[model samples]
Target: MHRHKILVVDDEHLIRWSLEQNLKKQGYDVLVCGSGEDALRLVQDEAPDLILLDIQLPGMNGIDVLERVRDVDAEIIVIMVTALGVLETAVRAMRLGAYDYINKPFNLDELAIVIKKALESHDLKREVDQLRSTQPKKFSIDSIVCASDSLSRVLDMVRKIAGSDAGTVLIQGESGTGKELIAKAIHYESARCDRPFVAINCAAVPETLLESELMGHEKGAFTDARTQKKGLFEIADGGTVFLDEIGDMPLSIQAKLLRVLEDRVFRRVGGTRDISVDVRIVSATNKDLLAAIDEKSFRGDLYYRLQVIPLLLPPLRERRDDILPLAKQFIADFNREFGKSVHEISARAEMRLLNYDWPGNVRELRNVVERAIILESDEVLQLEHLPREMLSVAGTSPASQGLNLVLPADGIDIEDVERELIQQALDATHGNQSQAARKLNLGVDAFRYRMKKFKLL
Candidate 1:
């Protein structure tokens, strides 16, 4: 690893010498300059990671040097050195993008603390930039594995529409059906793939804060808005902003969102300036927006704008052909994750997977596969290795595949049967109550109530 370089620019010889010695001892490649002109030259020639600049210089002052340094390389970390009473100039330097400032006659320990912070921030920025550069490949279309024609057609549609100029897209799907994944595919396939892809869930954030989260807020706009914030739309300018669970958005915010869709201009909260952003809007929801509009909870105009390129993701049961393929993918993923050698799914296991009603969709399938992979030690996933509920289905006769319900000659206990089924689901999920509840198509509270009554908790 290369050592970080630090440049100390000061007209005073003692201060520059002291800083250079201390920084050199700390394994930094230290460079020194007497005047602002010499400092600018060193900034170009040395290209130091950080510059400890003195506010009082002979020819060109430190403020001028800081501005010019930014002009040369905006990313270079600069810390202003100021006298105790020269705070006003230091504040101005901060506005010019100084990382932080230190008082002259500064404690060496305090200076060290500030320097450590600035360097860490510089490292984080580089890592983020690297991740941003590789995001397209990470979210590429090939990342989504499916064997069904319904998904294939949807992928084809994604490609066709990705090249369009700023078309609004609305993706509708059942919960856990990979709606966000589809949104990412559309974004990564588009012309603005290199830019940011900001996502926010309308349902996740509180209603009171959702508008500010989308449109940004000026400093002191509200009680807790102490600092200016750039919202999702502003941050995702020239790219895509994915509004997830858009059906749950408040109607008041819907009107604001509609204004943005109609005219790409929105004023920040408590601000007069209309900020314009060229963001592609891609909204997703599991709820029926038409139903919402009929119920007076959603805006019809916004719905029309959002549905310009509507993409519907079919539920897992409808696309039974993809279940085994998705299972195999999950097995491969878990093998790497858990360091296991499980390879193939048995024919019986596949049949059970195909027949079961996936109420929670793909996400549920992934969890089930992960659970089996973690529990089973065998090389192949057999019927016995599968979940108990799945094994129950697999064991039933071919005639009973469609409907396995048969009234016993001696009337069976219905409560006992319900408890047994719930127990099997809980066992299948390794005591994960939520997954079990989803598998049974019961609400979490209802499932908990049953578990409590059965003493399964």
Candidate 2:
């Protein structure tokens, strides 16, 4: 890790030398300047982590240097040092973005405390900025890419219902199908956009800790509870809480969740007082809740409360039109991150992408694209960029004979061979039309027409 750099600016050489010596002893890299002009020059050449500036300076004043520093990097922490009678100037310095004001003839210990606080504040701001960069921006639903009638209809329902505040939403989809993304889009686009959005994975947490995680616990509630702590629900008051994989929640916790939903109130784990929260509930699950209810694995009442507005997301294979676009998006993303210039995919590789079954859905597609980008050497990705299974599927149709008959081989009619394979696959699957169509890598309607023409259906 690079050293934390500190810049000290004061016209008094003795003061600057003493400050530099102290900061260097504390393991920080220090830069000393006799005047504000020299300080500005150092800032422009190599930006420092923090600047300790004296208000009184020769030539350019400290305030002028601070103004230039702020223009260069608003996030840089600045501390203004002034004499005892210059409190009013210090106040003006704060309005101009000085982090804190320190009076002269001050204790070194006190000054050290202020510096620590300023550094901590700067570190926290950096962390927040990083988190914001990773998180999807608010109200931008375009990131949830899909190109199927089923998914488009689901998105339309989400948009329409997102405006309303009364109904609870239940998002159903297979794992890796981006359920959490949908939940975020709903919360960020709603009236409670400014409020907190707390998320918890029901399946990820242990059964023993689930209650305490959902509801607050009083001090000494358990052996580890040294002090009282608010749970996720209390922290998310007047906001939204996303319960991912809701089907995996224990039956006991499910009952508690149901009570919270029905009455909008919950008691802490070991506390008598009840806490009321005006929160919106958004739950998602990969399992069939109705089946779980019938099997007594889940509470029926809670299921009903969660399913007020149901949204089902289709798996990637079901939305074949989105494959190429999603792959291209991932490719561009990885190229910039990995410092590669891979620009295009070969036609053969593109065909293989469309043909293979994406069992892991969108997440799987992203991984494949990233892997291909890493392995690819040239500007275009060839068939070798894909996994062996995908390549094999592209090489031979399961419906075809055992003979190795490559396409465009020895005057063989490619169209005739394709037609025969489609018929065989349909016949082999015993007219289970969708499965046969999937096996042949052809759309259902096209497979149906071919089956009829070949008199195989």
Best by TM-score: 2
- Deviation in angstroms for 224 in model 2? 3.1
Stretches of candidate 2 off by over 4 Å are 1-139, 394-457
RMSD of 1: 14.6
Candidate 1, 296-334: lDDT as tens digits: 999999999999989999998878778878888999999
Quote the positional error of residue 53 for candidate 2 in Å: 19
Per-residue lDDT of candidate 2, residues 402-421 (tens digit):
43333321234445556556
Q: Which is the leading candidate under lDDT?
A: 1
- Ten contiguous residues minimizing lDDT sum, candidate 1: 403-412
Estimate the TM-score of every prediction.
0.60, 0.62
Q: Evaluate all candidate structures by whole-model CA lDDT and list the values in order.
A: 0.87, 0.82
